[model samples]
Target: MTPPTGTPRPAQAAEAPARGSRLRKATALGLAAGLAATGIALSTEMTAGAAAQGSLPAGTQLYKDPNSQVVRWVAAHPGDSRQPIIARRIASQPQAVWFSNYSPSTVTNDVKAVTTAAAAGGQVPVLAVYEIPNRDCGGASAGGAPDLASYDAWVRNFAAGLGSGQSIVILEPDSIALTTCLSAQQQSDRFASLSRAGAAIHAAAPHAKVYMDGGHSAWNSAPEQASRLRTAGILTSADGLFTNVSNFNTTANEVNFAKNVLAALGNPGNLHAVVDTSRNGNGPAGGGAWCDPSGRAIGAYPTTNTGDPAIDAFLWVKPPGEADGCAGPAGTFLPDVAYALASAGASDPTTPPPTTAPPTTTPPTTAPPTTAPPTTAPPTTAPPTTAPPTGAACSVSYKIASAWSGGFTTDVTVRNTGSAAVNGWSLKWAFPGDQQITSAWNAKTTQSGANVTATDLGYNAAVPVGGSTGFGFQGTGSNTASPTAFTLNGTVCTVS
Candidate 1:
């Protein structure tokens, strides 16, 4: 999913293939499976537990792959300050690992290794097959096989790696949802490739459940997404659909949206859905804060225990704490952000909060900003120095809007208190405790250990004398003390 504002959309392509004869064969196999398909069978034994409506499904079985980056990090950094919380909140959970590279030669072996390990552990592996041409519309996660034939070849090899074990494949993200960016012919060819992909996977591993990308709750209307799913051969080529991968939308919202889309698809009660409940704990931050906005928390943990009959499971398609191309590169893991998300107790899995109030049960609408009177402060007359510049005279104020057990929301305002106008600014501070910023808005923010820098966006770069601009962030930690010192362009700002 695309970020709200200047954040670049992560490129979402990976490698797969298409051979005319093989495509025909795979498509035929998928069609046959669809005609003879019965709905998934539920195990008779269910673990008795009270799961939140859209949280992990009770009695559902999901596999936790041990090799995920977060899992490895927790093992290697057991002594780190953030390790304990991250290990408890994130590393322990199961998430899908993406195979985005187009390595035809090694793709099959890679798939086999994963599936083989999962089978030995009596678990089902979740695999994300992300290669598709022109993925992300040439955005940040871009790079796929050169053409359809190459993609077809890649898929065939990828499918071969399934090794007759239980697996779940999340087919290309944005491949269908973002098709409007493609020409009509491109769309048609892409759809065909997707169909071929599903067919190939099903043919290779009959036990593998394949889910096509359904965008997210906010992107396409049910009917529209359903139509696209049909055109992409979901019914004939795949088992079900998945949504909210790499995006933040409340699970409740995705549940409703997924059900509506399935209803629109008119499947005969066979198709189900999975939601990426990785980092939607506080839902979207509104105003298009898709790319790692502050104060966002981790959502429900991975589980097959979705209470809803129509929903299959809630999976962590996008691993928590991984940068979505803004804080870092698209998939680079950020420990502080991860810690903030995992520790955000706004929607604790044990006591999941209602995403929205009764009746609608959608994400709560963000409130309009309330204007506050300017604070009275003493002005400084320090001359602006270009080099070794002594600090610029400014005022900084911090406010905690909300707090939970491990999470809090803070807003910081900076005003030019000097006589001269400030052309550009950088606000810096350090957390007093283990606190980490998960998401931020109104500026470009980055964190290194406890220190953070919030740089002005173009529109907010210039602060005339007495003018002010502000940004907000959501963070996680037991201690949320206001940073004692604030700096603006090397000058210490008086805190209010």
Candidate 2:
């Protein structure tokens, strides 16, 4: 999702992959759910070498040896504590998913929410701790615990939230790197609290993988950053290190720096590094504002395929498209930035980078076209539209996915509250006002002034026996409808 108009948070990618000719606009809705949107899954088990996502160049196999075996097994099966909170999993070198947001007070509930979805398989979800003391390190995205004592209590809750499920805890972001702004005693106190936080989480979820931030390769020297982690109990209690939590750094550079930090910390085996690939194609612009920073594209999403054994998955800890309140209010949704980031990931996940990850759900952008092209002679058989599914839980949902002037892209979500998925669907709407489609991309967007009908073609013609398909269009007019109706084949779901 794009950063809200003018905010500090990054702009997560959330749209469709590159179309041969027409690029279907994507809404930045799935950003909080980090896992790259599309890619081939790891199908083979490794003996001494491994193959990961395209984000990491092929031939760069993680050793299938002892240590890697454990990691590989963990990588092969991504466990989502809560699938609903985390909607999609991006299979990059280091496979990772982000949990959808939940209240800080209910930290454990959120953790359970994600792990429940994970079921098993050892899939690691990215978890962020914002209830820290002096969060944001007093920068653009600043919002932390009211005080150190409160923060310590919050950390304890956060640790308990793990709930036995495996997770990659991205400890209080910018907590250490940006601590200079604090007073001497305040810094020390915060560090001590951070140590306790790590201890608490490790105690609760031994299966979890906790990594302390290493800033970005560009921000701190390996030796310097490693020293901080070491002091923060990284070597003793935490798994290892994490880099680029909320910044831009290429896979190679981040890996290189992470390795250096590990070597410096002198705990390579115990310490593994992960990179944040929410928005880093172009890397840092000259100035570097951090939130929705421009010239950025898409970096690798959280994955476990780091070329080096010390590196972990490239997870998206930051919710893409959600503004980093700094630029505006810190946590508002922005559509344009969301579209840009989602589109970038669909095309280039290793470009502009960010630190975001959300829930898990199936992403079929790169799947075989569900609809047939228009070249065939079936005049009635128009191409399947690029409408996304929705309302699977709700009785009805209207998805106004994307837009560009005259026409806007759309989709629908239908809840199969009934015993079965609606097999056939037809969308009908009358013109309470004047709206017409000037041009259409993924749908056979046809209209009779206010009367608009959109239907899927080809394989999508019939929704799964228990599933639903969305019909979309690119139309023009004031989006005002006194009565917009929908019919699944012949059954009416929405009436005016």
For TM-score, the strongest prediction is 1
Worst 10 residues of 2 by lDDT: 15-24
**Runs in model 2 lying further than 4 Å from the true structure:** 1-105, 120-122, 326-328, 345-496
Model 2 RMSD vs true structure: 16.7
**C-alpha RMSD for every candidate:** 15.5, 16.7
TM-score of each: 0.64, 0.51
TM-score of candidate 2 versus the correct structure, residues matched by position: 0.51
Cα lDDT tens digits, model 1, 103-151, are 7888888788778888887778788877787776665565667899999
Off by over 4 Å in 1: 1-60, 346-496
Q: How many angstroms is residue 285 displaced in model 1 relative to the true structure, after the best TM-score fit?
A: 1.2
Whole-model alpha-carbon lDDT for candidate 1:
0.66
Specify the highest-lDDT model's number. Answer: 1
How well does candidate 1 match the true structure, expressed as C-alpha RMSD?
15.5
Angstrom error at residue 78, model 1? 1.9
Report how far off residue 367 is in candidate 2 (Å): 32
Please provide, for model 2 over 1-496, each residue's C-alpha lDDT reduced to its tens digit, 9 standing for 90 to 100: 1111221111111211011000011111211111112211221211111111112222222211111111232244355222211222222223223221223466566456555555453344555554455554443343445777776666666667677655667676656665555665565566666766777777677666677767677665666666666556565556766666656566678778878887887754556777777656556543334433433455665446555566666665554444443222343433333433443453534423223454344323221221111111112654433333443321446656554455443444444444544433455556566666543222344677666665543334445434544433334566634346655444556431
